[model samples]
Target: MSAPFLRGVEALAQFTAREGAGAAPARGHIERLLVDGEEHEHRLGIWYANTKQRRDKLNPAQRTALADLGVTWA
Candidate 1:
């Protein structure tokens, strides 16, 4: 397992677990990560998501939920 892969997975999981309210989309957006084994050439983006709904804009309730999830947006 690569560090990039692990970081990406961890971030994705945290984002999903908090964003997905049992019905939220399981799909994820594209993200990039870097590993120690390679140079800039080793950087890559992996798209991974497993939910039921698509994430668009957050509603008032959803925003509150996100805050509760410890996510502070600017």
Candidate 2:
């Protein structure tokens, strides 16, 4: 992947880690990652399922954002 894409994935991983710790994730940053990291749906879904609370925090708009990026949940 390109460097920016890799960076986005890194940011997403950090966000997921923070969320797992019960911290409020940086929403804008994570959204940007989700938007830019379009090819990472599987990774994103795995991260989404990493924490129940964090997963629950994804609102309808966020789910729409993910869907726009072609991310889908099974």
Candidate 3:
């Protein structure tokens, strides 16, 4: 996977770990995660909303990955 997309997945994983599954983040939600020995911040909710909006555009692998993460709507 591309680095940025990987990071967003990491951010979502972290958010899920912290907030539990099925929690819909707010529009301004932010997730800070450690990835590749560095810290990165993801605009979690915005990314999520956008992902939902563009769900049909995601490739199978991307969709599968999100589904594996317990993202029901993915």
Candidate 4:
């Protein structure tokens, strides 16, 4: 299960790297990093301008939720 999950994450990471590298919005960014000591993986999405403008922006937990397929923000 972990192997397949990792593969999917790797694929998404690759796609994001190749496509989002140039097309990511100026105010936003997304990247993937191995987490939980590399046994687990996560994606990080950053909205710099939104954070700057909203001092009370939603916390990570509140701002993120698992999709139908079960991906979550880290």
Scored by lDDT, the top model is 3
Q: What number of clashing residue pairs does each candidate have, in the order they appear?
A: 5, 0, 0, 0
Tens digit of lDDT per residue, candidate 2, span 1-74? 44543453455455555565333333323333444556433343344444333546556655554344334441
TM-scores of all candidate predictions against the true structure: 0.30, 0.31, 0.86, 0.28
- lDDT per residue, candidate 1, 25-69, as tens digits? 234344232446643331112222311022244356544544454
Model 4 score (lDDT): 0.39
Error (Å) of candidate 3 at residue 47 is 0.8
Question: How displaced is residue 72 in candidate 3, in Å?
Answer: 1.3
- Candidate 3 lDDT over residue span 1-74, tens digit each: 66667777878888888888877778799998776798878898898888888889988888887887788977
lDDT of 4 by residue, 23-63 (tens): 32243344445555664332323332343345355444433
Off by over 4 Å in 2: 21-27, 30-74
Task: Look at candidate 1 and tell me the lDDT of residue 4.
Answer: 45
Candidate 3 global TM-score: 0.86
lDDT of 4 at 53: 48
Output the worst ten-in-a-row residue range by lDDT, candidate 1: 43-52
Better of 1 and 2 by TM-score: 2
Candidate 3 lDDT score at position 8: 70
Each candidate: RMSD to true structure? 11.3, 11.8, 1.4, 12.4
Better of 1 and 2 by lDDT: 2
